[model samples]
Target: MNVMEIRNTLGASVLCAVMFIGITALPATLAADDDAPARETATAEPPDPRLVSRGKRLYVFCRACHATEEVKGSKIGPNLAGILNRPAASLEDSLYSDALRQQDFVWDEEKLDTWLLRPATLVPGTSMAFVGLPQEANRTAIIAYLKTL
Candidate 1:
């Protein structure tokens, strides 16, 4: 082929390759926006402020044993700062009762509610000796407060 023809063909091939790459990358760029729908649906309901406030007051009891900080060895109980999203008894250094350690549950709202209502009944042989808040409203408030931490 003539030099000019060969050069033209090479340039065209490079342009096509670039265009193909750009097209493929478009989907990845768009994928991030897809999560917006999930987030919107997940966030439709706002948490109750009253419950959260009351729970904050109740959390005074928890502050004695647990802390909310991510730092290690901060308190007598496990650092509860991020307890909402974490699995039960999953804290690193805190010594847990065999019963609590063996439990496979995560600290979701329902589970926390039951646990707050009756700690020993929820998990038999647990080392957390404190009896739960007797009132359902108090327990619910505590759970709400814990979620905010």
Candidate 2:
């Protein structure tokens, strides 16, 4: 092929390569920018019906392991009835990890919030297999629903 023809072909190939790269990266760049407004922002909304209902919906996963029963014990996890204000791992029948059972604190809102964010982090060696609710809104919803139990 002639040098002029080769140069024109090479220029076209480079242009296509650059355009392809830009097109591929555009969506990811825009996605990051779209989330910028919400980054590090707290929810202005208080615990409302939407949050409670959302939490109730989220609680379906917990139902497999726990029950709302006060006296009847759960096989997978402890009964969560009246969990708020109750001491951690207070249920005598269930097997609680030493880290959790030794904690000398009640299941208050603040504590529950932290725990639900990451159960293993809150109590290392705890038996809970849940990774955690990373989303603040989801955690808030779950905690609100827990209050109803």
Top candidate by TM-score: 1
Cα RMSD of predicted structure 1: 10.3
TM-score of 1: 0.68
Error at 130, model 1, angstroms: 0.7
The parts of candidate 1 lying over 4 Å away from their true place are 1-40, 72-74
Question: Which ranges in model 2 have alpha carbons more than 4 Å from their true place?
Answer: 1-47
lDDT of each candidate versus the true structure: 0.83, 0.87
lDDT of 1 by residue, 101-149 (tens): 9989888888888888888989999888788878988988888778777
* Displacement of the residue 124 alpha carbon in candidate 2, Å: 0.8
Error of 2 at 145 (Å): 0.6
Model 1 poorest ten-residue lDDT run: 68-77
Clashes of each: 2, 0
